[model samples]
Target chain A: MFPSGHPERSAVERNGVEGSRDQTLKVPQRYSSTPLRSVRNDEKVSRHSSLCGLALGLVLIACAIPSAKAQDFLDHVDEALSFSALNGEVRARVSGTLDLEVYHFSGLSPGLIRTTNDTLFNPRLSLFLDAQLGPSVYLFTQTRVDRGFDPSDRGAQLRLDEYAVRVTPWEDGRFTLQAGQFSTVVGNWVPRHLSWENPFVNAPLPYENVTAIGDKSAPYYSFLGIGTPAEKYEHNPIIWGPSYATGVSVAGKIGQFDYAGEIKNASLSSRPESWPITRMDFANPTVSGRVGFRPNEMWTFGFSASEGAYLRPEAMSTLPFGRDPGDYHERLFGQDIGFAWHHWQLWAEFFEARFEVPGFTDADTFAYYLEAKYKFTPQFFGAVRWNQQFFGDVTNSYGGTAPWGRDLWRADLAVGYRFTAHTQLKLQYSFQHEKDGGNDSDHIFAAQFTVRF
Target chain B: MRCLVFCLCLLSALTRSAPAQGSVEGQVDLPRTKSAPVMTKRYEIVTTGGVLGTNPPLAVVYLEGSFPTSSNLPTKQVAQKDLAFVPALLPVQVGTKVEFPNLEKDTYHNIFSYSPAKRFDLGRYRPDEKPVPSQIFDVAGLVTLRCDIHEHMRGLILVLATPHFVVTDDSGHFRLKGLPAGHYTLKAWIDSRTTREHPIDLKSGSTLQVDFPATP
Candidate 1:
């Protein structure tokens, strides 16, 4: 991966380097680009909200039956009941998590955007329904209602983010086949992305930072350095958070090695509206996979790669005639490692992606983060993460190759305390700065209260 | 009639052997029901049950008043095996030195408790290490022990003020005998949050019958 101003810019391009542009101060239009696109985005949000309501309603109905005497039927399901009348094998359990978060970050800086209120607060809920059929088959789904799990979410809207069903052939979980809409398998963060698991409020730079590459249309590259930047915040990153694209996956643990592979309809950076199969097709499905090695219970290392079409079908008119959009794709490679010893837990990951923006040369970028958590006490803990993102070279409008975006790094410090086994409160503060920009307004303060039931 | 007369004579003689001490025996009225999940677990793999765990829903019965125990007592143990503390629930007298040994074949364990009764953090140790880690619980309160790594792993050490204590059997029955004649408070501890106590006048050589979850 090229580290910004490398002399061999053309060589990095040949080897698939990707560049990105970010504007933390610029406002992100929830529905971006032209006015027509914005209107469509609004409609899409309403449609998704309705769909989420229906799905959650179905999940609730499954927990009860129609009967005049069944007023409190669902609440009584604290224990799984195997009904002989129904083959005596069906047992179901419903559990959930509620997260209330408050965040305040300066929007008047070189980086730090995303809020309608000076002090913003929101509540997110995640419900899990698991039902076992006999000894080998099971059905499980996770439904979430969230207005951007964190402050990084562009707009304030609550919707279902993910749902999946998993199957295992044997009692021992050495093999599993999962289907439905689920998260990507390319990184180490997906497993602990939930509020109750992750200690931080904001995503890593790779997932949150916007690249000059846009999914809706041709990308706009900046001039040499950060001059003459893109006019709008219509850009994408190497990945937009945990890519919960609809797909099928197979994962298993054998001996000390674990492996997983996924085939999804949309690429990692596709917006939430395009995640559903009805909006996108598998003509050029994204294929991503990961292989991990665990020498022991204390340490794990993984390598992952993915290549797929990141452009949306609506952007077809923006490209030259007779060109297939899939030819210009997003290719990514990553490495992650985790170790837990005694009271210390550590994790680090490095990712580089190359986006072939239609008409323009490929954009190359790299992102990384190293985090460590210490258990200061049984009920309290402290964690810190060092994160940064750098862009390679891109041919600008003036016919010269230079970094298409600015580079930046951030340090996040967080502390958490568990009031009880089921409830915990986390507070975090971050210091961020661009390579040439000041950090006067780049400070971030956030807090989250999560309860699992 | 002759057999009944013989049984009465045997009971009378047994009472004379411990004339200076009283006893209490009872059955707890906690109904036998399936135990709900300890916490709301997300989509996870199958649970690998603990190697050593709590036996049936047992209760700890003890006297509540101060009763100084003898010094130079043996240190109690709560070993970490299969990523869990053996004997998930433990009851001990105040000042009992509790040892936490890592017994897993692989992986390390760090045993620590934030309970107000005994706040101690035994640093991490590899499996089967020499000299087990321990803490002498001097306070009379519930000490909840947990592994710093494995969040699901849990154990409890209930420290009592008096030396008279016994754990209930599978059928919820317990007997605490050989208590010096005195005015004492009898109590039952079901869990850290659930306990019932009642003042009692225990006379010499008398056996008092008690039942709980029935007005204390």
Candidate 2:
């Protein structure tokens, strides 16, 4: 049901010349420049854990809501009973990986960086429940617990990643209603979780938070709506409907080609006096869509684009320094042209953003990356990626090395081996060069293993 | 009464041709209820006569070391009466003649095959006292017998391979006759459930007993 075979117009199969507006991977951050240590605290983890417990408990209570015991007993005595059955099943999985990073510098000999750091392994646990309540209804639930490993932190923690409930009133499966915290249907790449759906072992750099957006960061696949109400609309009854497309979504079909649109609330500004304070409002709704073709069982191709504003806490926070504390309300635009053929895949996306803060005659920044990957076999593959980023002067006035100034070019090569379907080990090396000066280049060697059950 | 008498004579003549292996004994096993939400109290058994006669009432059902796959039925004419197909259950050999006589004055009837195993729509027929030349079912399987024009008229034509077979009566018991001494496999296939199979060694005159479990 994702996309019917439109082989010729798949997401990856496109002949149109790339336009200026078509930009790629941009990681939107919740708070740019804000220290990561500040946001990741013990309190937040504990609070989230409690909330997960309550939500799961509530779902359990909701399941025990109906019964007709007296009628069943009487029917048994009278030999007039009619009944169905209820059955449940559960499955679990666990996997891990290791990654080491080395570096390659441009205009210099290729060598390993002296400050080589490594990520030993990361494990994830997931529980899925499939239940058939009666003749007509069924329920599916998945819970994930993850342990992230960093050389600095020896301890690990689990998080309730997602909770969803899907209801089917009709057995033929024409209609369904789903509620809970789930993935938003945005760009094909944004919504697909790295561990769950992607063929590549590591996510693209632009798909990360540090580069794409100033503040709020969402990994290529993260979205949650706390009781937000949304419904889908379609002119043709059978072709389109909103069941899971909410908070952020992608939907619609053109001829044999299928397109999905995503919408999410972005940060906006109030009065000039409230400069540093970031308010969660409908500054702009990030709207994006992907149109793709799937001709047969083997291939898929798609083109995607989105325009909106993202929230950057550090930029929005009022700092005492004379420097403009930047703002989370950054106008952003993006376009991604991608296609995957059979087991082998390739894609490239570019992103550009502009800011209209007070002192800077408005600043514009651009970033783009080209990523290509091939799956040599089901268990092994390799990837190569290149990224280019540019930044504008802070003020229009004669610039004396304006507020911030520098551009960066980065490239990475990686090879991964999947020890099992749920576990993979990847080794990647990254090289970066500063167009200006100051710690301009960094050689990062990384090894990571991801597991899910 | 005269017609009934003639049918009985035909049944006697047919049963006589085959060696009659008398009485049989068996039981229908119902699974342990355990903690099932609903307890079934009453059950009903529907039987059909073999190629020769009406499924006999209270027939002695025995367990041959193995289950007998075939049940025989006569090809004789079964007329329409009071808007119902007479002798609703007809068990016949894989190749046998079945006569359908039109006895209704006001209604026409058509015996058709809608079952996947055997498919054929025997066109409609006018009311006539004379019987039409029989339909020979070459395939061995259950054929759901129905009427093309009448929605309520329904019946069954069970085409079988072996001649040794019988349908249980109201008490859920059945029997087969004249099974020679040998090792055989007895299997029972029920709708909406898995089939049961048991190895059975049948003897010249001995009766074997077996039970089949029914789930609620």
Candidate 3:
């Protein structure tokens, strides 16, 4: 429901449908006359069911031909035929990185510190498949794989992420919905890296450490529960353009700015009976919103914020049928700012988080990164970065780190180069120090390669 | 009749070809990339910023310029190559003659323009062959150009009175030359999807450099 006298409606009405919404193609599917297409094959054993399946199959074939063409190719009749319509594109990317670090403790002098080097060269791969079903409906899917650190080594049963479905009912696609698993709409940087289309290597602290499930967290960091459940709604915006929201999202435009907000339930935890599996839930319902402005064709800006209580699975109880209680809540707040010129880019972000424990002191943390880049060539650029992290209230954890409350600091210097369109290489060196005034510091080094298709 | 022939001959002597067709060249500068270089046989670079390629030549380029728009109705024009339509952007006036020079060595080509503004199709013809003299664009507006055989070959016939446009070069530079002595609206188009416009007054031989910024 939209608020009365909301400023965005008029903006949408005036500016027409937003461009982003218009271009996004949906995934394709055969809508069977049987209605319930998900039924198992064994269920169609009866003669009546067999007849129904055959009739449904015939109807689907009739509907599928034209529908797929319209939806996928914007109703281009010439491209509707299998021989006439080429319905796929080859999307790929390649990227790499290097990280170096020097460690020092608060009590130890810089001379006594030694460097513990770590390097990574993981290749990222992706495949995006798109097809049109009709003038108003289409289908698309992107599957990705990575090779570097064994996810199972990191306690993950499966390493892959992202299998999503989207639908557009309207011809112009001003209003649309997306269903299926997708990247959490929590932050800008966590979903996709700058090298893939972003401007920086590290996400703002709030985004890097909060809600997102990956290596960018502390020993007690949160993981993506199972999936973000719910449908996302987006309306064409007027001025700044289209905005996206999920989990009961409201999107559209207001005057010269585009805005979006969503309220959704995130998984907190899950545990199996008679098994050692204790899945954590970040499944609590949370709210997030973003507003963007575009004054002219060249300049654009956006601001986003979110707050949610993430469930901690490690705190789960082994009880057999009793309800498990949620005992920890992490509050996140952050801001992002970015700008792009013809050949130059600037981005900076700051975030602060507070982890609330039922029986322990509240742990607070802050992280920030500032970076600027210039495109020396279409595929090459140089940049300087400053990144810092502060962790406070380190308690002891089973993983060998102080519990939720520990204090530490890190500073880094980085330079990056891109050799080809998708291939990139980055080298970074950072210095980290402990706060307790004791001498425990080590050096860190990392290198990574990312490829997308 | 003899006096009319003498007058026509004198007029023909005075007429000359449109200014030897000079080229407009420029470069596009992109911000440095942060990660390792992407390795591919050929990199298809696209950004919120934009990429450059001619509808006809199909050469890859980086560009920064005004986006083309259909707000102000212009005459429809079409460019054809092979059986494919080229230059995708065809800014012409109503009743303008669009020459379809067949660049393909073997196939026949047919050009068609279908839109609310104009609708007409030129029957097929072999290479080095000509379609009925020319198709007259009687309507003013955006027209979609297509070929019968090559489904991917598509272009727009932007019929207009003023030709205030330029395409970005390999380096992303564009310049509109030889403007009429008056104030006019300048618009740039990319892929017929994104467009930007501005009002400017130019001297007959002045060159203006307009830099289009990549969306952040």
Whose DockQ is greatest here?
1
- Local distance difference test, each candidate: 0.67, 0.41, 0.37
Q: Which regions in candidate 3 have their CA more than 4 angstroms from the true location?
A: A1-117, A130-140, A147-160, A167-176, A190-195, A198-250, A263-283, A294-303, A312-314, A318-327, A391-412, A437-443, A449-453, B1-216
Query: In model 2, which regions exceed 4 Å deviation?
Result: A1-123, A126-157, A163-184, A196-201, A209-213, A216-250, A266-286, A291-309, A312-328, A396-405, A419-423, A450-452, B1-216
lDDT of 1 by residue, A1-453 (tens): 324453234333332333423312221222222332233566657755654564455334323322212422322332333121233355455666777666655532122234433345556788876555555555556777766543434555655566776676754457878788778888888767777778787677777766566777654322122221133234566787788789898877777777888899998877666687878889879999889888876788999999999888877766656876687788999999988766788889999898886544678889999998887876688899998998786653223455656677889999987654455678899887766443223677777777655
Fraction of the true interface contacts (Cα pairs closer than 8 Å across chains) found in each model = 0.14, 0.00, 0.01
- Which candidate number would show the highest lDDT if scored against the true structure? 1
Q: Worst 10-residue stretch by lDDT in candidate 1 chain B?
A: B45-54
Q: DockQ scores for all the models shown? A: 0.14, 0.02, 0.03
- How do the residues B67-115 of candidate 1 rate in per-residue lDDT, one tens digit apiece? 6677876788898776567877789888888888777755667777766
**Whose lDDT is higher: candidate 1's or candidate 3's?**
1
**TM values, all candidates:** 0.75, 0.41, 0.43
Q: Which parts of model 1 have CA positions greater than 4 angstroms off?
A: A1-95, A108-113, A116-119, A129-140, A149-156, A220-233, A396-399, A436-441, B1-22, B36-55, B79-85, B101-114, B119-133, B145-154, B197-208, B213-216
Q: How are the candidates ranked when ordered by lDDT, highest leading?
A: 1, 2, 3
Per-residue lDDT over A82-197 for candidate 3, one digit per residue giving the tens place of the 0 to 100 score: 22122222222322222221122222112111111112222334444343333333334444444311111112122223233344454322344443333333333432342344
lDDT of 2 by residue, B1-216 (tens): 999999999999986675434333554442322221221000000011111112222221223343344445455555665455676656666677777776764345556554544655444455653446357777877665655334335456666565655655545555555666577665554321234556677665788775554542
Better candidate number, 2 or 3, judged by TM-score: 3
* DockQ, model 2, C-alpha based: 0.02
